[model samples]
Target: MPADPAVVDTDCCIVGGGPAGMMAGLLLARAGVRVVVLEKHGDFLRDFRGDTVHPSTMQAMADLGLLDDFLKLPHTEVRALSGQVGDEVVHLADFNGLKTAAPFIALMPQWDFLDFLADAARRYPTFDLRMNARAEGVIERDGRVAGVRAATPDGQMEVRARLVIAADGRRSLLRDAAGLPVEDLGAPIDVLWMRLSRRPADDPEAPLGRASAGRMFVTIPREGYYQCGYVAAKGGFEVIKAAGIEAFRRDVAQAAPMLADRVGELASFDDVHLLTVAVDRLTRWSKPGLLCIGDAAHAMSPVGGVGINLAVQDAVAAANILHDAFALDDAALDERALAVQRRRLPPTKAMQSLQVLIQNRLIGAALSGRPLKAPAVMKLFERFPRLRRIPARVLGLGFRLERVTSPDAFSG
Candidate 1:
């Protein structure tokens, strides 16, 4: 027989401490609701997680009075976006025109962002963050979720709560355990991620990607290096590996000519990490006593790099909609928790719809060795500088930008 689980109680038990989980925990704890966030990893030092904090996110941080402190962290700001299309460099977006406090995308490592949020949230009396605690299954009572069973370094533990939220990335174990169905929107390409030292002279801020005939190369400027990606067609890594790592490096250099000099830094295949691209969404984002947000609700492609922003927005929305219930001391949180899904589902579907459209219409074509002819509509960005605001607004603000609307108990 298995050992008895140690039981702990909380108002809200959140699984998987990512963008959504951390943001929600902070906001709820601020509202004086007991929150327990479980992070499987002891530290948030993973590479190649969501790195772009969109202007919408920055604006939210500003609204929460954390902008100044947030900016103190080491980061790169992208005020404008540019890409090489068919041997020509074109300005894609101009964030300087956006109507927000911070009108640029802050490219900070996901680990740093998570760490900062966790530190800030720890200030709240109701915040309980347990690192190295991996949620194994959902605990249910009377056909409704009541808590979570998690595995830790020491032993199995049970956290009983009024509600459980799953923010555990795309492959959410909690979501699977909850039996929520997912819709696969499909992805045409996978990315091989690696790093190359950045030159002091390189353009520190560049657009999302540099794509050409059969290649899409993305290089993000970090503190001292370039985090690069080599995108390939679905299930295409075998062919790439067979051709050898040198050939792959040469192809990446060819796509993004600016990195030609440092291509040799990718000395072996071990240096490259393959990220299988997936675009999907859950059929239903909520259940009787459980809710799923962020990548657990929907997984986005790398097209706009807006997944993290959307996930954070989901957190804000969740806190806004459900905090009142907890604040009112409601033990039966079923209907209100479902309201979170009702409020956020539209925006989640809208973003995923747009991503699927772009993946099918643009990225898929690019990955298939087809040359992308710049549409005449794009000429407006070049001709009328003000027109750049269109895409900048979309990329920065997204389909729906959520703000912190819940009352903070600390303010009282």
Candidate 2:
């Protein structure tokens, strides 16, 4: 624990400004709790962040009455998911016929989404966002966590709060500093993310994937280009590099022949970046005055692009529990924190299990040059459109979907 030279005070202090932390701040601020959200980065412009906003998240915006305004922002809506299986094109998951107002997944840049949430949070008088503020460790008072020590853009500082939220990402600083045990379920593959130009002549218009004997390629349509992902085996980048960038480009062209002409545009490896995917959860998510949500509590794989949605759900549950707890100035913050874990852990475990299964069953085989076989149930889902609803329910709505139940639901 860093000895505190406290410089700030609030009812609640959140250590991250991603979906979960910002949403919690937004809701808590509306409920009249003074809260501060610390984001180490000054902006959310990083590329390769998950851009899929599933129907569940759109429904949350509707519940908040911000759906119209949110849709106004530039985005591409993927109504149904289709992909090319080995030797056969398949209809995988469909989002149409869903009960939600917006049934499709919204494909907006991740930064724009965060900016929208941050702008919404600013409407609340109790919310404060500190940019370029990185949390160093917890500040302990007696047996409970009382504050956070951080290295700010200016200098070292401490922020004291009644409750602290660790929403910082998969590799979380606060979670580590608090001595939380993480359950690493492991991932079999990593992703190479890059972009390519999209001309008007491109076919197969919706976001989809291509799988061959040993490789997988996914492309998400953007305004003028495609955000692409190439899956590689665990610790396999070295092999990809040894094969050379031109060889890699040929591999991409082979996986998705539609972009064969554009493969030459890949240019250099610098244009590509690696996302070492993992799916894991913490043994415990709360201790004393602290609570962990989102990636801090459970790191998710990018299988369904549902990680961001799940994190936002965690935020709603946390705000529903803690906003009023701060208003009462209660002493049993540890209990409240534990309650948040209880509400979120089951769903977290379930989602991670599903992700790990996909990683082991689907991705592992794809990387090892085995024929990609669609599961029998998935084939049933394709033939009988009614059965597709089952996956739509799981992929779109999530296992434990959360609605904002706070008295201050959309006010923020």
> Ten-residue segment with the worst summed lDDT in candidate 1?
326-335
For candidate 1, give the lDDT: 0.86
Per-residue lDDT of model 1, residues 1-412, tens digit only: 9889888999999998899999999999988899999999999999878799999888878888999999999998889887765666667799998889899999999999999999989999999999999999999999888899999988999999988999999999999999999999888788888898887575655645776777778778877788888878889988999999888888987887777888899888888888999999888888877999999999988878898998999999989888878645444477787777788888777877878887776667678788776556666678888888888898899878887888788985
Q: Return the TM-score for each candidate structure.
A: 0.96, 0.96
| Tens-digit lDDT string for candidate 2 (1-412) | 7454549999899999998888888888878888999999989998889998988888878877889999999999887887777877777778888888799899999899999999988988889999999999999988889989888867788899889999999999999988999888999889999998998474556988777789999998998899999999888888998889999999999988888999988889998899998888999998887899999999999898999999999988998887667645446666788889899888888888888988888777777898877767667876798777777778898998888877773443
Which stretches in model 2 have alpha-carbon errors above 4 Å? 1-6, 328-331, 409-412
Q: lDDT (0-100) at residue 296 of candidate 1?
A: 94
Clashing pairs in 1: none
- After superposing candidate 1, which stretches have Cα over 4 Å from the reference? 202-204, 327-332
